[model samples]
Target: MIVAACVKLVDLRPGVDRLTGAVTPSTTLGCSAADRAAVELALQLADSWSAESVVVCCGPDRADPVLREFAAAGVDRLVRIDATGAPDSADVAGLLATTLAGLGADVVVCGDHSLDRGSGSVPAFVAGALGAAQALGLVEVGTEGPGTLRATRRLDGGRRERLVVDAPSVVSVEGSVAELRRASLAATLRAGDVPVEVVAAPGLVVPPTVTTRPWVPPTRVQPPPQGTAALERVVELTGAMVERTPPRTVELPPDRAAALIVEQLRAWGYLEAVPSEPATDG
Candidate 1:
């Protein structure tokens, strides 16, 4: 069994400085807490199943430090998809999904969201690319058997849903589950030697767009109102012509009020117009 964790290095702020209007050549990048939890969960699953644990990320060389940290902690393999940065989530997801498909990943884990582009859509995109089942935004992850993983999803109104995900599935976890464990000094030193497998990324596929005229409502043709007097035309144009029954206030005996309500209900189609029993002379 192979378990792969999808990790990302996110931008700390906008590239352009707002005050100076100068291009901020250097942008800070780091792993999100949710990504840390994702790696930890992958480690747990890999350890439990005695499967190979792999961490894959798409970023420039600056991501090496964070990748090494994942290695030191316990990942068996580190994969860096060749990319400086993705223009959008679609590109990143494509790169990661292709890599995982080649890896023949039986289980794919991802963070609920990233620090940048927090739509939490990469997992869904990856799953769609691989044609695999996806269970996202899970708070609890575990295994009920050798081939299926059990999870709990947190929902609105303090609601929770339990689900079982089988192998060849994609799962996303929230950051609140557990904090990532620290790597030991010895492990860190050993990780320095671990090789990061770099994979060439596919070209980004931007959506096809065509520039055209700005939108404007089409002119609608309407027949002239019959015998258009200025007053009638004004009323018609302003929509002051009324058709619905006007509201009425009625005071009646209890029995009569009840009958009136029933009659109105019938008129409004709320009640069936059942036929009254035929009156017979005794």
Candidate 2:
């Protein structure tokens, strides 16, 4: 049996493409904590069932660093689905379904939600595409010997339901379910040389999305305040008009007056000093 874990390389710090105004993944690539847990779950399943473990990723060549990282953590195979630009959810699901079908994967493990979009709908879409059984939002997973699996899923109001799932199944798990194991130095060194298999994603038409600014109410025009006196007009226009305080005359000596003026200026933020460095004699 072969178990495949689907992972994504999200941008730790995303940058906007100036020309297209689309969000671009940065060089600082890393999988989400939930994806890390999915990989770990796949590895654990492989260990228990003696099944070959595979980690599958979908991204461009620049996303190879994350693939290498997963390899070091010890999956039997690393496959990169060649794709560029941000594919829509349905397109991504189609790509994954096609790849998994080609691999003859008996089990597919994935994180419940992606860091980019928290829709958590890809696993369901993949299951639909492949005509496979799905157990999503699982908090616990275990084999039921041979072709069956045991899963406990989270429900609304902090409730969990246990399920018995048949094989050729896709399951999405939460990050808190498992932690990935550490890789030894030798394994890390060897992972760098383990050639990653590249597969081209099947061409799928991503549905176009329409984006528009929020609707705002138009500005309301009102007639000028009907009042004869300026103060009455001001009162009508503002609803509440504050009278300015009259300036007071003060009697003080020149030095005291100067000091008081300087203090007032400082309080009003008009006496800020520039940072300086000691001059060096050259």
C-alpha RMSD values across all candidates: 15.8, 20.1
- TM-scores, all candidates, are 0.69, 0.70
**What TM-score does structure 2 among the candidates reach?**
0.70
Whole-model Cα lDDT per candidate? 0.85, 0.85
Candidate 2 lDDT over residue span 164-266, tens digit each? 9998899999999899888889888888888889998766554554434445556779889999999999998887765755566778999998988787677
Question: For residue 63, what is the lDDT in candidate 2?
Answer: 77
lDDT (tens digit, per residue) of candidate 1 on 235-258: 776668858789999999999999
Q: Cα deviation in Å at residue 241, candidate 1?
A: 44
